[model samples]
Target chain A: MEGGVYLNLPKVAVLTMEGTNNEEEAFQSWRGAGANAEIIHIKKLENKIRKLEEFDAIFFPGGFSAGDYVRAGAIMASRLRATVMRDIENFVDAGKLIMGSCNGFQVLIELGLIPNIGGDYEREAALATNLSNRFEARTVYLKITNNTCPFLRKFRINQIIRLPIAHFEGRFIPANEDLLEEISNNNMIGLKYVDPYGKEVGYPWNPNGSVLNIAGVCSKSGNVLGLMPHPERVFNKYTQSDWPRGNEEDYGQLFFKGAVDYLNEKF
Target chain B: MKINIIVTLKDNVEDAEGQSVLKALHLLGYDEVSNVRTGKVYYIEMKGNDLSKGYEFCDKLLANPVINKCKVERDD
Candidate 1:
């Protein structure tokens, strides 16, 4: 369907930077979900060529930004914090939407967007190196833990979905035990790694050995979401690994669509 | 002055890289090696001799306080 067919379609900015790939698919996913999408370089925002305020939602695609120097997503997060932090804070305050996957998820954690327990954007969690000690590249099962998040409204609680995850540092580690409790109590965890049958069998099923089998998390407000899996890559059922095995679910498209629907109704 | 910052995962956190290195060392007949921890060192040159600046840099960028501990040292 043409975006022109929909009035006031949400404008999405797929934010990218050097070494940050996957913007192409992310843009396509947003457009497929009936949103106007554009791939914007970080430099554009830094140089004032384009402003975050112009977009209704922002998508941070996957890949190693700044070559993953210092840490995955650390460089990009620091640069954004140094330059457009105020704009981001304003965007969040305005109740807009934000989503990130894989390295993008790492950026959100580094920026302290998800699980911003202090409400000050102070870093409170880290996506540490995988306990497997190697880069895990495979499609895994995820159980939707919180359907209240805009990105997950199309899903149901305890619904199992399949998405591809590729990364070396995908483990979700909170700053402390109290923070972990807060994330759980607030229903900030959006997804959890699970088996094909929705069992929490550790290892290859969990992939990263993330705490509490967390595969994705959301901000306390449920507007911002970050996950280690690449939903954009699997927007089509044919792209899923088990599609040849008679899988017919296009699980990824719902993520973008849900957010777009929310943006249109709310913003 | 040159400031050096060493960033490593906190002691309580599981160090997968360190464990891998320890396993490799044990295989190479270095059984006496009890432990191995991994970290990154950044050497920065500054005109001003301010160790606090280095700490500030670490806090803002070089180190993520959630999983990392940064030690800043000044070399003149």
Candidate 2:
């Protein structure tokens, strides 16, 4: 495992729904990072849920599913609730990794996948329209909240990474002040808006007016993560906005790297 | 029971959609528009004798705190 370049990389499954448009890119990104990956459409999972067991990790990529009607992620969440909830619970209960990006994050929250403590149906965070009230497509800086979550194991505290966010509703709202404080104190806040220079700025630094400038959050167990930033969109240097001149390496690579490393250590 | 649910952004929270509407209204010569915020209205028919359970549904499942607030009314 130490000597091989692709040694012990895990097999990742990129889950797709009727309207998910980013599955291929996510698959490519994870594969490029040395993980064996493939896209698994929701339709395929409708009849059977055990297919999820074949992979070490699962990902829900970003896209405008079901025309984003009712809400950006409402339809997808409903579908998951109707079908894959049990499979997801079993996977997470097994300590397997699960990730949702952008619209995918919305689905996870809608399906009650993350932020639930002990109950079968618990509400997690919600992603609504941005504070700007318009679809914003731009590269925003994010401060990685220092935590022991497998998702952020390789990231440093206050590290600024540029990621593109394109959505009408990306604002993250948690349920209560106590839950908010718990998430903050536990370092479950995965990302927060920051200045271009990598400093944590408040409000406006919060590109979406999300509470506490939060860009993303995870469950207390850290096995589930939901975020708005498109790490798959920035896996390569060329896709990075400041590629040539910036000293920063492609931060999106860490998403795959961290998961693979965690899985490798498990077996 | 039939209930009406009104969901709106909290006071401190910004309303992007409502702001756009206000801007549009101002452009249409409604210059007196000082502030504008948008909200959702839902008419739901629930089957239950207890109103608390209905409100619980709205509080726990329907409304999200980080972005919106919800109010419930008995249609009758």
Candidate 3:
């Protein structure tokens, strides 16, 4: 039946665990974009009830997964690395489009999946506590630095979009300048914190004092994207903090939509 | 044996927590203190005297070599 094509949408797993409260919105965003998405507990993957290869893509939603006590995204990444590191590594290597938001971004960095300079899971960076020394929750303007990344294809290069970021450890600093140079040279820097006017700014404008004002990044392959922003919360304009200010377009949904669209077109 | 591990950001990395603490100390009239840095301490209890295992944990899980360094002290 030709109508069966609609029933064969790509499956996206919005992985979750106790304290990870953002899976619902992430799942909705994926499903809203025509993917069959689900809120899957990390245990399901760990216990092998569900398999990573079953899904076309996997998303790590924002939340204090594992209470974020030791470090943001530390425990969850450690657990996953211990159990399913090979599967996840292969998933990224296979270009299955993995994405993470906010705390999930921290997990990616902890897992050494982003800016994976040498194709090895060597953690070359750390998302330390914000320079302001507090959890910041605000809408920030991000300049899309690289459109070649599948996640940022909907956005034009240098396009500035508004997204809300909420986190304490949002500062993205790599281990050394060499690695930073490598990421920049590879165009792995996907999003940069900028003012609404699109000027690279500092403090309140930058929001997290990230090095070079980086807000999001992709791997060298650009299939995996990690950003410290709550794109899921703004699936619609009404969810945006500035909705009353004549906000109309939903920029956040475009990201997930782009990923889904890429998956559909590719596989 | 009990092993105590102290983990802290490398000296070059900016310690925002330490700066905030310094600010508080200045407000408290203790102006002589020149520097402050925040770090973590973890105590691991084990039965073997294999010192290399402690360093191994430090290299792998206990400390992020990218931005942190860890020191292990043995307490028998």
Candidate 4:
């Protein structure tokens, strides 16, 4: 406030509710990156106790929210649409950051927030059940496709990163062919599955049989991102599935750090 | 009022579960089964006879248009 630079710290909200078990790790990741982060329950927002506008950035962490019944991420998204749809729309239009990972990624698609190529907030894609016909839980390699998204700002384009993903519904498919083209032309794709050697692969390597090997995507504005992986599970080399080999660097921390840094500079 | 809703994957979308189910049926000597697909059905009893409102609810929350198509009918 003294030198025209805001002295107040940026606040990031890691939203959660019953059945959302990943909020703790996601909260720690944000706080570890020098942001004032909190785990806020959806009830707090719905009951008017907390407003979504209060936070500079918002994260929908991975979990089986609402028991993941009906469909993964359906119940929670429906509840939000029934009440705070306008608030979310405005938040996105204002260029605030929003990220959803794993089951949270499913929620983002259900909420019509990610890959909103037309800016209509229409549900144009789905995270369908995997072709494997079972839950997939393991570490996989992902190549960053576009770094324009705030969440991927830390990674170079086409850089391969290893992260763990645990989900039954992780296959990303667009509603139609035209929408797929729009996503590509708009540069909304954020990550694509690849082998450790950086070759485009399928099946066990791709893990989910997603279209174009897409692992994650963002909104046209690049503020909203959704991915079916758990970066929080690998904040350090010790936590990674197979680590201490490469650079032993904590690759997962870069994502949360990028978000915090972006918010700090923009706000 | 009673309503029955059926939700199915779009025609172009691959039904991996349905295909697997069909494969199992074939192994069980059910060669008569030419094809198989999976879907969800919801039977609800509402307070009014507003069919349009029922459809709206289905469109908004009951099914995702991305990979699903829904059919709503009166449960007569």
Q: What is the C-alpha lDDT of each candidate?
A: 0.93, 0.79, 0.89, 0.87
Model 3: residues with Cα > 4 Å off, grouped in runs: A1-7
Give the Cα error of residue A111 in candidate 2, in Å: 1.9
Task: Give the candidate number with the greatest DockQ.
Answer: 1
Write the residue-wise lDDT of candidate 3 on B1-76 in tens digits.
Answer: 8998889999988999999999999999999989999999888899889877887877666676778888889977
Which DockQ values do the candidates obtain, in the order shown? 0.93, 0.38, 0.67, 0.67
Name model 1 segments beyond 4 Å from true.
A1-7
What does candidate 4's lDDT look like per residue over A1-267, in tens digits?
A: 243332376788898977887888888888787778889988888888999898888899998999997789998999888888888898888788898999899999999887777678788899998988779999999899999888899999989889999999999999879999999999989998899888888899989899999999988889898999898878776899768667756777988888888888898
DockQ, structure candidate 3: 0.67
Question: How much is the lDDT of residue A51 in candidate 2?
Answer: 82
The residue ranges of model 4 lying beyond 4 angstroms of the native Cα positions read A1-7
lDDT winner between candidates 3 and 4: 3
lDDT of 3: 0.89
When sorted by TM-score, best at the front, the candidate numbers are: 1, 3, 4, 2
Q: Please state the error at residue A4 of candidate 2 in Å.
A: 15
Best by TM-score: 1
Q: Model 2 in CAPRI terms: which quality?
A: acceptable
Error of 1 at A4 (Å): 5.9
Task: List the pairs of residues colliding in candidate 2.
Answer: A128-A169, A129-A169, A173-B66
The candidates' interface RMSDs, in order, read 0.5, 3.0, 1.2, 1.0
